[model samples]
Target chain A: MSKFYSSVTKKIWMSFMGLFLMTFLVVHLSINLLLVFSPTTNLFNEASHFMGTNPFIQLFQWILFAGFVVHIILGLILQIENWVARPKGYRVKAISEESFFSKYMIHTGVIIFIFLAIHFVNFFLVAKGIIGEIPKTLVDGKSVDDMGALVIALFKMPYYVIGYLIALMILGFHLDHGFQSAFQSLGLNHPKYTPFVKGFGHFFAVIITVAFMSIPLIIYFIK
Target chain B: MDLKLKIWRQPSAHADGKFVDYQVHEISKDASFLEMLDILNEELVNKGEDPVAFDHDCREGICGMCSLFINGRPHGPDTAITTCQLHMRRFKDGETVTIEPWRAKPFPVIKDLMVDRSAFDEIIQAGGFVSIATGGVPDANAIPIRKQNADLAMDAAACIGCGACVAACKNASAMLFVSAKVSQFALLPQGKVEAKERVQMMVARMDELGFGNCTNTYACEAECPKEISVTNIARMNREFLVAKLS
Candidate 1:
């Protein structure tokens, strides 16, 4: 319970779980984006079928689910603890005089979490067979059926695309702080690698935001 | 050189604090900023008024006792070096300087330019140490620390535990201070035995003390008198992950 409740330890937990979730995002984006390059339904279906049936992937799915739960719950808990601990807040007026991202993490993280819920409802539910099957789409001038088509079709909705882009932007903001910060929490920073890590973190955030948002734009305009 | 001073004055930690304005005349351009303050204090004493209260000892800047936010930046307008080490030459003859104490909620103003930094002590007491013991100082070659690791450890150890990092931080985070300590110990073979517990305890204490989380704005490092790297924070996180899993 102490491990669960300790705010500092929770930060370690958050960083640990977040790194795993980051890997999951990479895997998820790779598999979902198969609609654009994979020229055949059987291949996409075969990939999805493999994902649905693989034992190692199934274990990873459970771990990923746990990661999401820990990330969200502990984030909220740590934030609440911070609020309760510093009810008086800083006496000086400084943030407006400094960086903007330092002050807006909570707002951006909350928005991202809201987007996460929507993502789960639309994609996770459909993938798990908890929700009704989404309608298929015509890809490369042929009627195709699979999870990849569902992703492409969902992005075709203008409102969904807008929401997704906003979510990705918020995620970018979160990563701007989180990427370097996680390493700091674990005490991994050093002079030789610190600048490189920060540069890489910013680059990672830009890449992820662009990659995630590009899918929706590609489906709506290019495809 | 003539200079304008806007220094914070509080009767006590319980008393309300406010900035009081004063003027200094015929100051040497080469004298350190604290010398200028000393000149003003002497004038005030000659005038039969109480001298201003500020923290300083070595005045060489390593003690970490001289914590001040000058003109919205910690340790004056300079990139590094504490207020004691800040030379007055940086400022123009007629420039107005604003001096204030560390403003974080965890660091309460004791009086004038000095704030209570016991929260840092508390964080250290919670974990920042190596519990292992040797009978006496062992041979230097016994623990062959790689040159890279030794340098990194020395760099982390360079942190003066000054609240300047906190003062400069927009979030008022002590991550730079905490991470430096964690990294300093974790990098050495002597400190590795307690690495797991040290990170866990130190971080818990940091959060427990009501300090805000690190947002990696680099403001702390930018304002640090020692220019402590934010990389220590990253190293601290990596150590914490290993601790959590194992």
Candidate 2:
């Protein structure tokens, strides 16, 4: 147990949690895309209903929550340790030639955390009946939470849409460094495959950002 | 070449330091960066001023003794060379140059431009060696190491224990240095005997000494005089994780 508390071990945990969250984003974006592409169909509501009510996902939801909390906490702990490592800074700031996305991770992470808080309050809490009422609509004569309606309505507001876009742009930067960083931390780096991993991480970051951003933009403009 | 130098002037480790500007006239562009400093120190001594103290040995880049954060770089403006290897030609004649000691907490300023890097030695003491019975030198080719592994191990061994990686890292992480040390042994059969305990002990000592965690920024690789790859860091991470788990 004492061995698990080492710096490397902490990073390993962070990597696992971060990679898990990355997969969760894929599932989340796929379901959220329904708000734009399949607005007229019952697919979006059905998926939401399944996500909200399924036994497996319901259990997994807590695990997913734990992943986010653990990742954030570990990040903070590492950052604090990093701060203490350099008590006195240099008179001339050391210039960074590359990995620009890597430096401001904490700043980007804080923004993402803020966005997550607003997101949970607006959607997750409402769905859980903790904040506001969950809007309902009949799906095949079975009543379901109108998550699509709630999302579409929120996206319709220019302020919310703008904030979401900004938050996601920051998230893109965070993921840009994070994707390959997670793999590197997990000790998976190799000369042959590391270049590909880095390239793919950049590609993945852009794809996830653009895909998630398109939902809000399309909903605000066209829907 | 004539240049203005803003050099950190700390009398001792406990003294508050500040950048003191000086001018040197008619310095040859061919002089090494340290030789240029030597010229300034000589002039200072001629005027009964305290000569600036810094560390250097073997003027070749191998010893890794000379350290200066020159113009915001670990070893001046050049890449892949130590301070002893950096020439005055890299700088413009009239440009202002800044030089200071490595600024990590563990590497406290000893004087003007020399830092206490003995922390690195302590980390090495933790677990940087393989225990072998005292005997005659082993026969050549007796170990039968793979050529690829040998090359990789040599690359990791090239590290000179300079704190430049720590100096270069924004977090003052010694991961690149520690990783290189760990990799040098982990790749060869001789090192495999105690690789598990070696990695764990070294990393624990590194953390106990207040070195920052690697954030995978690759800054340490960029600024390393030895050009030690961050892959060694990845390998160290692998070795460390396996040690912790098993």
User: Which has the greatest lDDT?
Assistant: 2
- Per residue, candidate 1 scores C-alpha lDDT tens digits across B79-190 of 7788888888899989988887887778888888888899999988888887778458888798788999999899999988889888877657788899899989899988
Could you list the chain B TM-scores for each candidate? Answer: 0.97, 0.98
Q: Over the stretch B1-246, how does candidate 2's per-residue lDDT look in tens digits? A: 999999999998899989899999999989999999999999999999999999999999999898999888899888999999999899999999989889888898898888999999998999999886536778897769999999999999999998899999998999999999999999999899899999999999888888888898998999899989999999999998888778
TM-score of model 1's chain A, to 2 decimals?
Answer: 0.86
Could you tell me which residue pairs clash in candidate 2?
A: none
**What is every candidate's C-alpha DockQ against the true complex, given to 2 decimals?**
0.27, 0.69
Each candidate's iRMS in angstroms? 3.9, 1.8
Q: Over the stretch A71-142, how does candidate 1's per-residue lDDT look in tens digits? A: 888777666654554444334444323445646777888898888888888877887788987554554565
Model 1 stretches astray by more than 4 angstroms: A1-8, A38-63, A80-104, A121-133, A136-160, A183-200, B1-5, B21-28, B42-50, B92-96, B123-150, B182-207, B234-246
TM-score of each: 0.78, 0.98
Error of 1 at A7 (Å): 5.0
Q: Candidate 2 lDDT (Cα, whole model)? A: 0.91
